[model samples]
Target: MQVIATAGHVDHGKSTLVRALTGMEPDRWAEERRRGMTIDLGFAWTTLGAETVAFVDVPGHERFVTNMLAGIGPVPAAMIVVAADEGWMPQSAEHLAALDALGVRHGLLVVTRADLEDPSAATELAQAEIEQTSLGRIEAVAVSAVTGRGLPELRGALARLVAGLPPGQPGPVRLWVDRSFTIKGSGTVVTGTLAAGALRTGDELDLTGVAKPVRVRGLQSLGRSVGEVHAPARVAVNLRGVDKDTITRGAALLTPGRFLLSDLVDVRVHGDPVAGLPATLTLHLGSAAVPVRVRPLGADTARLRLGRALPLRIGDRALLRDPGRHHVAGGVTVLDVVPPGLTRRGAAAARALVLEQLDGVPDVAGELRRRKLIRGSELARTGVDTATFPAPVAGEWLADPAHWAVLQDRLRDEVERHAKENPLEPGAPVEALRHRLGLPDRALVEALVRAPLVTRGGRVSAGGPAVPGDLIRAVETAFEGLGPFAAPEANRLAELGLGPRQLGAAVRAGLVVQLAAGVVLRAGAPEQAVRRLAGLPQPFTLSEARQALDTSRRVAVPLLGLLDSTGVTQRGDDDRRTVVRG
Candidate 1:
C-alpha cells in the first residue's frame, strides 16, 4: 500500500505517465535524461482525492530487469504500464509474471500513450494477455501523460485499486535504501518508501548490513521536511554517523530486531533456466544483490553459497538468477539463509516441506486471521506480516479454524492427562504444558491456556476433575497412608519419584491442597486432623503436640490450625484446647 512500481518494456510511456500524474518527471538521472530512457529506478508521488500514492518507476529495458525488480520488490501494488501505441511487449509479460509470482496483489494496468493510437486497442490486447494469468480481471485504463489525456481516469482507477488494500499496521520501521547520496546541507540522505512502520525525526535506527547505528536527524517527504512518516510514504531520511560513502543502495535502515542478516538459504526454485545452474549466481533480496555459488540438489533443487553475508529469513521470497545474463534463472522461498545445509534430498520431500510451512490461507486477510495467535518471531520466520496474521490480540497469531480446533482438543486432552496422573495437584503449570506440547510456536500454547481455562496461583494443571484414573488412585493411596498427618509436601511426594511435575498435577487436581509454606495435604485431611485434635485430652503447646504426633513443629501448627478452624480444637492463652462431642 505504500509504493507502486511501474514496469513494462521501455518506450512504453511509463515515465511519461508518471510525469503527467505528478508534474515531475521520474527520470532524474542525467544519463537517463540524455538517453531519453530510464536505465534505473525513478521515484515520484502524487495525491488523488483523499489518498496519496508513491511511485517507483522502473526501467523497462530487458538489460535492466534486475534494476526494475529491485525497484518493485518492496511495493505491494504496481502500475503495469503498457504503451497503448505498442500494446504488450516481452518485458511487460515478464514484469506481470514476476509481479504475480512474487505475490503483488493490489494493482491496475495502465495503458499509456493514448494520444498515439486507439488506446482501447492496446487496453484490449493487454487485458487479453493478462487474463491468461492469475491477475484476475486486471483493471486497466488508457492515458497519455503528454496530452494530459485520460489523466483524470488514471487517477480515479488508481484510487479504486488502492481502496481495498489492508491498512498498514505499526511495526518495526524499515526503509530499504533504494537510493542513497549526499546533498549540500543535508549530509547523507537515503531515500526509500517506508516498507513497514513509522519513522520519526531524531529516531535512532540501525543501518543493517553494516556495523553501526544511524540516527535520523531529518526527514523529507516529497522534498519537504516532515516530522514523522508512516508506511507507504516515500521519504528521504537524513542520517547521523553514516557517511554517503559508507552506505549505498541495499542497506536497510531499520529498528533493531526487526530483521536478521544471513547468507545461505534453502529455497524451492521455480523455472530453473538450465538443467543445473552453474556454481555461481547473484541473489536479489529486497534491494540488496550479492553473488552466490549455486549447488543444484536436483533439476530445480539447490543450495546457494552467497559471496557475502546478507540479512534473510524463512519464507522470504528471493530471486536467484545468473548475474552475467541478468535474467531470472528462478525464484525461491528462502527456507534458511545462513542456515545449516539441508541434510535431506528429493524434490518431493522438499516441496512438501515448503507447502507445509505456508500458512495455507488463501489471502492476506485470511493469513492474518490464521496466524493471529502466532508468536511474532514465528510469524517473522514465515515472512508474513504480523499485522496480517490473525489473532484476537496484538503479538499473537490467530489459529486457522482447523488448527484451532485441533489445538483445543489437544489442550483438553493434555490437561485431562495431567489431572489424571497427579490427582492431588490443583492444575497444570502453564509453562510446563507449553513445554510438553512442544509446539513450534510457543505463543499458541500460552493463548490456549489464557482463554477458556482457569489459571489459579501459578500452576496450569487441570482446572477441574480432568485427572486420569490411575493418577487419581495414586493420589488417593498417598492421602490414605498419610491420614491424620499433613499430606506430604510437594517435595516429599516428589521423593516418592512420581516427579515434582506429577505431584504438582495432583495438587492441581484438588485431591490435595498446597499450603502456603509448601505443605501438601489430602483434601479431607483438615477434617481428620480436627477430629484427631478434638480427642486429644488436654491443652497442649507446640512441643507437646509435636511429641504426641511424633513429628516436627512444621507439622504441628498447620495441623492445629486445620483442627481449630474445623471446630475440632480451640486456641487458649498459651496452648490448644479441644472441643469435644459431635
Candidate 2:
C-alpha cells in the first residue's frame, strides 16, 4: 500500500479532483461541504491496476496549512494541485517551501480545472517553479474534472509515482495521531499514517511523554479491519484505556520503551533561516507542530526548548516556522534528543562542535561513549552499523571500544590492589568488585578478568596468593618419608599450615593430593593406587582391593572414586570394580 498527500493553494479543486478520481467523498464533515472548502484532513483511496493507492486530501487554505502539513509529514509522496485559471500563487509557494523543508522529493504536479482556461501555460509554470525546490523536474498532467480530460493519464502517472517511492522508515512502530474521535460502541479511535514498523491487534503502545501504555483493541487500514499492519499505510487504531480528549493531534503511539522523549532537542541548522525567526518558533515534526524556544549554538547548530516532549532521535528532520509570520525560518536536523543545558561559558560552542560531526549519518560510537548504553531497538534508527561499532559490551547494549578498554584496564588494576590489601583472603567479593568498577552486568566484569586474574566461587583472585614459601617447604618435609598410600590425618595436616582453604588451594596448585576428607597423601599417591589396583583380579570387591593396596577403606574408597572419575577404573553395579581399558 502507498499513501500520497495533496498540496496546493485553496480553491485549486484538490478535493474535487479526489472525489472524481476515487469515487469516494473526501469532505467528511457537513460544515466543510456547506463551506465548499476542506477544513481538516480528508481521506480517499483508489485501486490503480494491481496496486492500492491511498490519498490524504489536505486543505490548502492559509489557515489550514497546518492541517496540510499534518497530512504530508508522514506520507512519502504528494500531488501539488494548481487551478489552471490561477497560475502559481502565494500559498502555492508556501506549500512548496514546506515540502522542500521536509525533504519530500517523490511527487508530481496536477493542473486541475483545466477546462476553464488553457492549462498548458499553468502546467509549465508549475513545473518550472517545482524545479527550483527539492522535488525537481517532476511530471505535470493537466486534468479537467468537469470534462474528464487526461484523468486516465493522471491515474497512470500516480500509479507510477507510487511504484517509485523509496522504502519507509524501518523498525518498531510509530503512528502519529492526526485525527481522534469516538464510536458509539467502540470507544476512542485514532487515525494516522503508519510511518514505520508494524502494529498488531492487542499491541501495547506508549503515548509520547506518558508513562502508561495504551493497547490497540482493533486496527483498520484503508478503511478495513486487519490483523496487523506495516509501514507506508494509513492506519486507524481503536485504543483502550484512553478517551478521545486524552489524545489529540500531535500525540504519537509508539513502540514502548524504545524512543527517547525529551523537551529539549539539539539540531544542526539546515537551509537559510527565512524571515529571521523570533526567539520562539513552531517546530513541525511528523504530524505534530508545537512551539519552541530557539537558541543558536553556532553557524550550523542550535538548541530548541520545547514546551512538551516529543519522541525524537538522531537524524530526524524538522521544520522551524514562525507561528505569527506563518513562514519557515529554517529546517533543523535533530542531532540530540536530550542535550545538556548551557550553564557555563563556552558550553554551547563546545556542543556545537560535537553536533557538526554528526551530519547525514549519526556518530554512533561517539554517542555510545557519551551515553554509555543505548537500547538495541533504538540503535537501528541511528544509521550506524553495530558490527562496525567499537567494542560493544553486550548484545542488548552498545558501548564504545575505547571506553571499554579503559574500563577493563581500570578494573584489572583495582582487583590487583584488592589482592595486595588482603593477602590472606580470596580475591575480591563479587558484589564489592562490581561496585568498585561501577558496572551493572557481571558478564562485563568477567570478560575483563583475564589470565592470572580468575573468578571462582563468586570471587576474583590474583593467582591465590604467592603459595606461602614456608608452608610449602613444611608440607614437603612432613610427607618425605611417607608411603604412597600413607596419608596425613586432619590434625596433622592443620599443623602443617594447611587449613580447609589452604589445603584446597594446595590441591588446586598440584602441591598435594586429597584422597579423602581428613586424609590427604603425597602428590604421587593416585598413580601408586592405580598400579596396585591393576595387579588385583580383573573384577574385585572393595575389601579385596583395599587389602591388596595395604590401605583402609577410608583412603581406598575416595582414591578409587578419583581413579574411576579420571577413567582409570570402572565401578560395577554389583558391589565390584574393574579396570577401564581406555
Candidate 3:
C-alpha cells in the first residue's frame, strides 16, 4: 500500500482534490466543515490505476502549520497541491521546506482548480517555485477536480510513483497517526502511515508518547479490513484499551523497546529567512504538536525541550514553528533523545552534542547484528528492531558494519593483553570487558565470541588461526625469565608490556610451559632441596629443608613445601622427612 500526504496553501483546493479523487470528504469536524478549512489532519483514500493511495489532508493555514507537520511526518511520498488561481503562496513554500527537512523524497505536484484559471500559467509558476527545492523533477499534474479534465493522467502518474517505491523492510514498527476518532461500534480507531514493519490483528503494540499498551483488534488498509499491513501503507487500526481522548496527534504506536520517549533531542536547523527565533517554540513530530523550549545549541544547532515526551529516534525529522504566529522556523532531524539538559549558555557542551549527533552513522543490518549481543534495556535504548521487523533480538541495538568491526578489533586486543599478563589466569572477565566497551549491554561481546573472529572460554580472548613467530619469541623470553622460580602477577607483567599476548603466542606455538598454579617450581632452592632430600630416607622437617638451603628456615621451608605440593618431592611418615624424585 502507498501512503501520501497532501500539502500546500490554505484554499489551494487540497481537500477538494482529495474529495474528488476518493469520493469521500476529508474534513470530518463540524467546525472545519462549517469553516471549509482543515484545522487538523483529515484522512481519505483513492484508487488510481489499480493502486490504492491513502491521503493525509493537512491544514494549510499559517495558524495550523503544526497540524500540517503532524500529517506529513511519516509520509514517504506527498502531493503538493497548489491552487491554479494563486500559483505559489506562503504556506506552499513552508510546506515544501517541511517536506524536504523531514526527508520526504517520493511525491508529485498537483495544480488544482485548473478550470478556474489558465492551467499553463499556474503549472509553469508552480514548477518554477519547486525547482529551487530538493523535490527534483516532481511530476506536475494539472487537474480540475470539478471538471475532471486531467484526472486520468494524474492517476497514471501517481500509480507509477507508488509502484516505484521500495517496500519497507521488516524491523521495528513505527506508525505515526494523523487521524483518530471513535467508530460507534468500535472502541477507538487511529490512522497513519506504517513507517517500518507490519501489524496484524491481535498483535500487541505500544503507544510510545503515552506509555500504554494497545492491542490491535482490527486493521484496515485503504479503508478495508486486511489481515496484515506492511511499510509505506496507509493503515487504520482499531485499538483495544485506548480511548480517543487518550491518544492525540503525534502519539506513535510502536513495538515496545524499539523506540524511546524523550523530550530533549539534538537537531540541526536549516538557514531560514526568519531570524532571531525565540528560545522556545512548538515542535511537531508524527501527528502530535507540543510546545518546546528551543535553545540554540550551536551556530546551526539547538536543543528542544518538549512540554511532554514525544516518541522519536536519531533519524526522525521534525518541523519547528513559532507557537504564536505558527510560522516555520526550520526543520530538524532528531539526533539524541533524553539528552542531558542544556542551560542556554553552555556553548561547548552544546557544540559537543551537535558533533556527536553528526558523527558517523551505520546501516541498519550492522546495528541489528551488534544488538544481537547486547542486553535487553540496552537494546531498547538503542531502539533496534524487535522480532517482527527483522529484529532478531530484544533489548539491544544494532551497530553499523564499520562500528561492529572496530568493536571486534578492540575486543581482540583486550583479550590478547589479558592472556599475556595472567598466563596462570584463563582470560579477561566478560563483565569487565562489557564495561570497558561502554555499550548499554554485554550481549554483543557474548554473541561475537561465537563467531569465527574469537573464542570465549571462562573468559574472552583471541582465538582461531595460529599465533605469529615474533610474538612467540617474545612470549618464550618472558616465560624463560620467570623460569622455574616465579609465578608472575598482573601489574608486574604489564610493566614488561609483552606478557599475555606474547605469552599466548608462545603457548600456541608450543614453546612455553604456560604453568598452572600447581606446576610452578622455584629453580635454585628446589633443586638443592631435592638433592638434599635424595640422600635422606624419610620425610624431612621444615627446619631440615630450611637448613639444607643454607640461608634461613623462612625461605627454605616454604620452598621445600612448594616443591612437594608440585609433585617433585614427597613427605615421609613423620612429615619431618622428605623423599626426592628418583
Best by TM-score: 2
Task: Score every model by TM-score.
Answer: 0.60, 0.75, 0.64
By TM-score, highest first, what's the ranking? 2, 3, 1
- Candidate achieving higher TM-score, 2 or 3: 2
* lDDT by residue (tens digit), candidate 1, 1-582: 357788788888888888888888899889999999999999888887778778899999988887887887777788888887788888888787667656666778888877888878888888887776546677888777778878888889888877866677576776778888888987999988776688899898888756877789899997789999888778889888888887877878877665666666556676664346777777777777788877654445566777776656555666776657655666676654433445656754564454445432224444444343445554454345655544443244445666666766788788778866755566666677777776655455656664557666655644444566667776666655564564565565555554556666666556766554556666765665555554556676676666656655676777677666666667798675655533
Candidate 2 residue 105 Cα shift, in angstroms, is: 0.9
The prediction achieving the highest lDDT against the true structure is 2
User: Distance (Å) between predicted and true CA of 466, model 2?
Assistant: 7.1
Residue 580, candidate 3: alpha-carbon lDDT? 46
Q: lDDT of each model, Cα atoms only? A: 0.71, 0.81, 0.71
- Candidate closer to the true structure by lDDT (higher is better), 1 or 2: 2
RMSD, every candidate, angstroms: 10.1, 8.5, 10.4
Per-residue alpha-carbon lDDT of candidate 3 for residues 257-301, written as tens digits (9 for 90 to 100): 666777777676764532366877777777778888876656666
